[model samples]
Target: MPLRVLSTLDAAKTQYYHFKAIIVAGMGIFTDAYDLFCIPPITRMLGHIYYKSNNSRIQPAAEAAMLVVALLGTVIGQLVFGWLGDHVGRRRVYGFSLMLMIAGSIGCGFSMGTTQARVLASLGFFRFLLGLGIGGDYPLSATIMSEFANKKKRGAFIAAVFSMQGIGILASSIVTMVVCRIFGRKDHSTNDADIAWRLILMLGVVPTALTYYWRMMMPETARYTALVELNVLQAARDMGRVLDVPLSQIAEVDLVPPSPPSYPLFSRKFFFLHGRDLLACSALWFLIDIVFYSSNLCQSHIFDIKDDGSAFDAAFKVAQFQAKVACYFTIPGYFAAVFLIDRVGRLRIQVVGFVLMAGLYFFCTYLYIKDSRGVPFVMYGMAFFFANCGPNTTTFIVPAELFPARFRSTCHGIAGAAGKLGAMIGAAGFFLISKGGDDPNRDEKKTGIEVILITLGGICVAGTAVTMLLTRETMGISLEDNEKEYEGESVQGKCFP
Candidate 1:
């Protein structure tokens, strides 16, 4: 590597070191976690407000109605916003999603009915709109932040942003507990619960507004601007502006056009290439979402009955407690993954994550022994241990690194959509599986998530294998320098970790 280039690259990174990208990215994730985790509380509050005294209706049916509607909306969000993230810039997409969030929260706040059927029917349409915004967030926030961050510390930043999953869960639990403690401490007044829950739903607007601020401050991706023009040099110049360096600073000394485009993702030698790697990324992402969304959304059932005086009320509190605890594990796990990815290398960390998740799944088999309503907390702690620290972090980091500059945003959109597909399947699977069976509450606790975890573990392993074969290393090099290494190439001072 050239001396000035090496030091300048380090300096460019250092200049932005304390600049607050971490906080912005973390908050983005916090909003996501808050949006999704509040479901259990919302359901409990809804039932208490509108249907508890009826005593003849099933809470499970009410819960299922809300979940399926929200999940379907989320799937739609993923596809629509994901394409927008590629076609539109990430900053702009945040505003569009925020509008959806604001509208949904407003709809949910006003919903009221004296009957279960009225309650479910009203909240269903409201929450579906909310899910659309939540779905839009995954690709837009994750993709933009990944593109803007410095490479050496990129893993940590991305993982840190994702760690908001835990924080959001924790924040929602704290809010739910506070609401319960103040109001429900005396009596289960339907009117009180109704007002309290509606207030919480309205609070979602706080994040929607803040998301606008966070996104507005961020620069449109330098790489993205350059690519749309279809000029590598202009792309470098755009990146140079963001990095606050001159165009002369980052461009290759011997610049010619980027390599000729290859048509297929899978080709001769019968292994991974850019296309195959992207395929693997898309497929695996879709698979993981299947497990993650289902488990997260089904918290009320997974934690099972508390057997306290009010089954629905007590179950909601306990489920929040368990989810809060799961957050504790993931927070530290994210930092650990960030520290290790560049040092140990991306593929190794991802494989280790997959292996760890596989081991966690095995333990779930025993945890789900007959008639024993297991503590799903520890099982998820293990999964989070691997996920935040492993594939969850690396899988997101790798796609931006692996694809050629020419296809980066397009490929990211495709892979992100693929991951969304997995999330949709997992969410839908949980919905359908819960929809089936005479006793969904009992059955989901018994067999629902245990089966899904094993399936996610298997898909993660396959995705990891694709990286090892087709992907080249991306550690400690500039994007331009790394692209050189990808085409049977080498660059001075540019070495893979």
Candidate 2:
């Protein structure tokens, strides 16, 4: 059988809109990382301000909720917005997610009440809403960017969008450092600390709000137009404008309209075709996030390996240290993935990342058990570096690439939702496990931390195995062809090839 001709989107040369889409979509991811991560440094600060006693740290349950609540919201948001992106249009529902984020961020900043319980509840509620917006961005941005990008550079483009996450992490640290420096020098009052946390949370609004207009202006993806909407002419025109190519160029191609699946997304037939792929995407993401969020949310505290000076000073020092590591090491890993994803291929990168992360975790565990200080810190940083350059990046990129366009956002949402579920467990479980640190039992606390580290290593090993068994390499394949090959039918007609 002859190969089916590619559509305008797949065949189009790389152009300006690709980069434009990257920035527009990338900023959303940037906001996500910033909002999600900025909380860790301030968790203690909130305790100081609201509880008004240095000894009164956030309760283990409340702290876990604070860390994981947004994840719950993200899971819901990903499902709702992902389906909306498919059923309505990607452009139509895109900006609303940011709007939700803006509101949630501001609400978090203003979170206040007569008692600590009220304040914690208020903050958690708003962060959950923010998570919803962040969740929506996952599927919408990945799907839109994937559809807009040419096959030749799709992996790099998608990974490039995700790399913004590294920048967001850096920004979270820098902003925290600057805020602490400004506030820490003057008055160490609870009120001052309160103001500082609010400032940090509210700062998330700037980048998200700035991108809203550009996000609204982005045209619907050509593939969504052609295949999902069955409007070949409009898809061609949209592609022509975005790619800066003549309509004649797009017009010359023989376009095939995608066949409406005979089965619904929940049908056995659909499951048979995509169930393995969905499981691969979801489970791999789940395993990756378990390690990713655990390290990320707890790093500042982990680096506080020794009992230090004043509580305020100690917290400030930890934030600054974490920020510097993120700036110097973590951010670089993201760009490395962006550079190597297309060149080295997604599966190889993910496999390498998981294996290296596991090895690094084991190394860190050994160092922790032996009371080796500086080296463990270095290994932890290296683990973070590999996480970004490996599974963290590929898990995101692969789901967008492997799914059928008709349900692309929905599938991506499911995978993203699975990841957030893992994040919730990692955040909440780590909080519970590490509660041993506060106990009079020093050995127990040490054992708890070591166990967490070893467990993360095991999770990474499991991730590597799942990737090996379940997923297919998607390097250099056009999105349409990838879907058609998987579905085993022509795009337009139902006839099996």
TM-score to native of every candidate shown: 0.79, 0.93
- Write candidate 2's Cα lDDT for 1-497 as tens digits: 21122355665677788898999999999999999988877776766665445364556677678888899999999999999998888888999998998999999999988888888889999999999999999999999999888778889999999999988877887888788888888867877887888998999789878888999888888767766787777776776666777778666355555566455675787677778789999999999999999878877545543334433564566567767778777888898998999898888889999999999998888888898342366778889889989999999998898777788999999999999999988988887887814555767767778889999999999998898888878888777654553455623211111
Q: How close is candidate 1 to the true structure, as a TM-score?
A: 0.79
| lDDT (10s digit) by residue, model 1, range 1-497 | 32233234434653563245566656656766776667766665555455556442235656666666766676678668866766676667766776787788788878766666776677788888987887676666666666666657655566666677777777777776677677767676666766777776677567547656755666566555544333555556546655667767777677554444343323452233355566666765665566566666665555553433443365357545655556567667777876787788776776677777777766665666542756467776767777777766666666666554444544655666666566656655664554522253765545655665556566666656655554555666555443342435534132223
RMSD of 2: 3.5
Candidate 2 Cα errors over 4 Å, as ranges:
1-6, 54-56, 252-258, 305-315, 372-375, 485-497
Best of the candidates, lDDT: 2
Error of 1 at 316 (Å): 5.0
Q: Global lDDT for candidate 1?
A: 0.61
Clashing pairs in 2: 257-492
